[model samples]
Target: MTRKPTSSDHIVDEKFEPWERNGRMPLPVVWVAVALAIWGTGTLLTTSGGAPETAVEAAVQQDRPVDAPDSGAALFAANCATCHQPNGSGVRLAVPPLRGSEFPAQGPELVANVLLRGIDGPIRVDGHDYDGHMPSFSAAFGDAEIAELASYVAATFGDRDDGVDTATVADLRARAVGQGTWSGGEALAAAYPGLPPQPAFSSASVTPVSADVSALIFEGRDDVWACASCHGDLGQGVENTPRLSGLSADYIAKQLRDFQTGTRANEHMSFVAKGLTEADIAGLGAYYAGLSVPSTAAPILGGDLKRGETLALVGDWDLGVPACFSCHGPSGFGVAPNFPALSAQQAPYTASQLAAWAGGHRANSPLSLMDQISKGLSTDDRRAVADYLASLPAVPAGSTGAVAKEGDGHDL
Candidate 1:
């Protein structure tokens, strides 16, 4: 009889999305917002053309790039001040002190080399032993900038008046090619006996190696280890590592460049990528792309296969997640020069990548597609799709499923 329905008579939709209950902004978006706010505030302060009246204004003057401060001081403030305090008194038992230390006082060449090629392992400064890894800034800075940074550190911390020159830095950089992070400060001290001694690992020693020794660039040169050592010889990849065999050379080179620039963060990859020059990146990319390997990876994540299959092919429109194959290509064979083949990827690697995107650890995807899509996926959803992709047959870039042909631009 068409009576008004009571509150208890209401029914929930069968397609109700659990993810919609949360209203949190993605972490990356939040960071971007904060950065914008700081910039805006700094801009307002700078336009006033008066001494900073507030603490925020003062911070903006010292820390922000307002008025473009001295290059060396600015570089140190942005990069080094976080660990080594603004005064150069470092974190206790972690990063060693730089102020009044004899370390940087060694020589302009030594300081410049340290900046060009990082240092790590145990080091003693004024009777305190500190073990810390310093990343290479070579990729981030040109010879002139590095010279400025080195000269600044020496004058400020080592109390030296002799400044490093750009030519000296350029020459040192050329000689340091193919050398990975320095073993320790001790190694440097031994290499330049004029420097102060610090206890170091007995195994730590420096033997300068030329970059020209590699028969194949993919095999690496000098202290730069071979790509095949970690990624399989055929680029099949092992566990958390990604498969590079069927990827486009352009994509591979782009990723290495991103790693070098710290756009994508992976300690091991960044270290290795920093050591690679443009030619090395191009050669390695081509070398890996040319390789063809049967997928050795298997689904070990114990995800629901039916759910995974549905997600990979059909997608959950309610949760705003698109089918994996819509962009990856039919049968997940990949769309060549852009999208990567996911069919035979290791489940662990795939799931980790999805998590990284969702957590804002990775932001390199085109138009932030992966970051957006990953945010909508639950952990179970990620594992399900990863396992499903891993279960698919691995094929060459031009081949889809059981089919084999050519002229797809990824002919292997």
Candidate 2:
């Protein structure tokens, strides 16, 4: 059988031989390519108009609920509730109460104006004066959202049944283009003269105190003397004592703690601080932080008023002193969580503290910045700047003070 090889054996099927002998693609590969082509073509045809949604788009769609867009209460709780409070009875002296306020009740237009543009300066609400800034909502909220917020505020606080309309909000927003914040009450009054007459200033109208403040400060707790005895009923301190109203809660608490630890030396305050518990310090801080009073501080020291103004507004670069406003905020309203407001602070207290810093008697200033700053100032210079600060408004009209910079030493 092996005697001779036949030619028939050598001559194989032409197509099969070529494919098998040569390194060509396998049948499975060809089939896979064809299947993939078919699937890609089908997918293209099915979604010819657009590509599939991105992960971010899908996530956004899933995250937002339908009702969230229209819910005024939800928006308020997210945005306005922090300062104005949940019940709309805003913090006294710090924020104006909306519950019984006539401003919102007048019309949606007035509220829209405020919401869109914001308002600033010393405003007399009820009988109390509030020197603070209301920020603009134009950038934060859309027309529809603004309308919803206005409606809610009107209905809930202003007692208005009809809420504001989106169209009206849009129109007002359009008109507010290129305009700044409303200056003050006078400016708002000029715009719409039909506002309710402000009641006469009443000393009796005091900020509502918490139970803790009442037990400890208003009424003496155990051996501790009543805080109101030295600091006035409204936390507006008498002669030689520092004004406590509108000071940052953290600053107040820190000072008390410092006093207790003998880090800050004051005969009366040291004794008082020793008796205070941690809870007492916190309560006292919060209570005073909520209280705001009009500044009646005047320059008793015979410092040059113009020179004082110059020093406060822009510091003496020749002497290497920084502007008071640079750290304390433009109008000395104080930066939150740290800096204490100096605009309405008593002149004596400010001067004494400055002197203390210069003499190394007080060592609790942030980074010892006050220590270095005070060292540059002479006794008369200290008095001059202190007087100027006392004379300035806590939150000046149209000034950029409330918008604080991140992580800076604030003025006390």
Candidate 3:
């Protein structure tokens, strides 16, 4: 104890922790420890990832803008609100309701093109018409203005998420420049080809043997096709066949009598109506006018109601299109005599008429604006617009023209 401590003695006396004592960890142990830590960290990260933030949350965190541009509201107010209205309910007969219309939501390009070009002559809007001049904005407004207006209409009135931009307007403007003015019939034909041919009315198949008033006139006689042959089996009418449902009995009776008396002339209808007796005409008129009109609502594909309203009232003048309400009447009930009511028509039936006009199947009248419009429409455009029309409810009778009730005089 008295002698000086040696180096060995000092080393034995020093306290050493477990880690300090070992120069390095065992290879396997080290690897296992690192792997465990990594796994734990990865699990934590995955759990956090599973609870992703919502778009609003992300925007809040990133400080992104959410409000629409000021110009969007301004453009809409100035150009679109007149027909669409501030509340977007749309006018009853003169214009279609924009809040639920189908054309604005079709796509930015389609909406833009319609705005630039305009439409004309008895176009249906929300089952109504705004048959006035729809002036062209293409020459007056720049791409930005059109884009802003379209964007506002699509988002606010159409209830769509897709936004319009300048690019879309520019593209439509270019297309309008290349194509001259378009009539409704021309537009429709250009859009949809391969439309089915009009079937000849078969009186033989339609004639009824029973003398029941409703059966004889509405049901037709054997060897004489019933009115329903070319019209819908339900009187809704098919492709190229006009809808007979919901028309006034007086109007219908008058038309039938006219056909028989040679007062009215339609190649197909003349032959059919000419053979009908007064009793037959009366029965048919009563049967059709008495029947309730079925609902024609279907899921619209690629349309926006807001845009439809605009096209209906304002029209795209640049494209030589005319306003729908001019001939169709303020409400889509039509002006009577020649114009057909457009509201509440079946989707299939509507599509067929557009296709017929485009294909030159139904245009026989010298004043047929439909033929001109059908030729101008692209297939896509026809579908978009017709779908919009099909979605609308029929206008009440008294808005623009006199309406005949079920028992009204025999003039549908």
Best candidate, TM-score: 2
- Could you estimate the TM-score for every candidate? 0.45, 0.52, 0.43
Residue-level lDDT tens digits of model 3 in 1-412 = 5988788765743576656755887899999999999998777667656433443455455421223457778776755564456677765654556676555645545556667876432334343443322435687678777777777677776676776677667777887885644443235234434222222221121223336664544566655666655776656654446666655455676667666666544566777776677777777765665443433344255655555555555555665656555455443454544454555555555666667777876644336677776676666656655555554444333332342122111111
Model 2 over residues 102-178: C-alpha lDDT tens digits?
77777666877898998665566766666656767798788877877887777778887776677788889989999
The 10 consecutive residues of candidate 2 with the worst lDDT sum are 394-403
Model 1, residue pairs in steric clash: none
Candidates' lDDT values, in order? 0.71, 0.72, 0.56
- Candidate 1, position 222, lDDT: 65
Residue 18 alpha-carbon offset, candidate 2, angstroms? 99
State residue 29's C-alpha deviation in candidate 1, in Å. Answer: 70
Model 1, which residues run further than 4 Å from truth?
1-219, 397-412
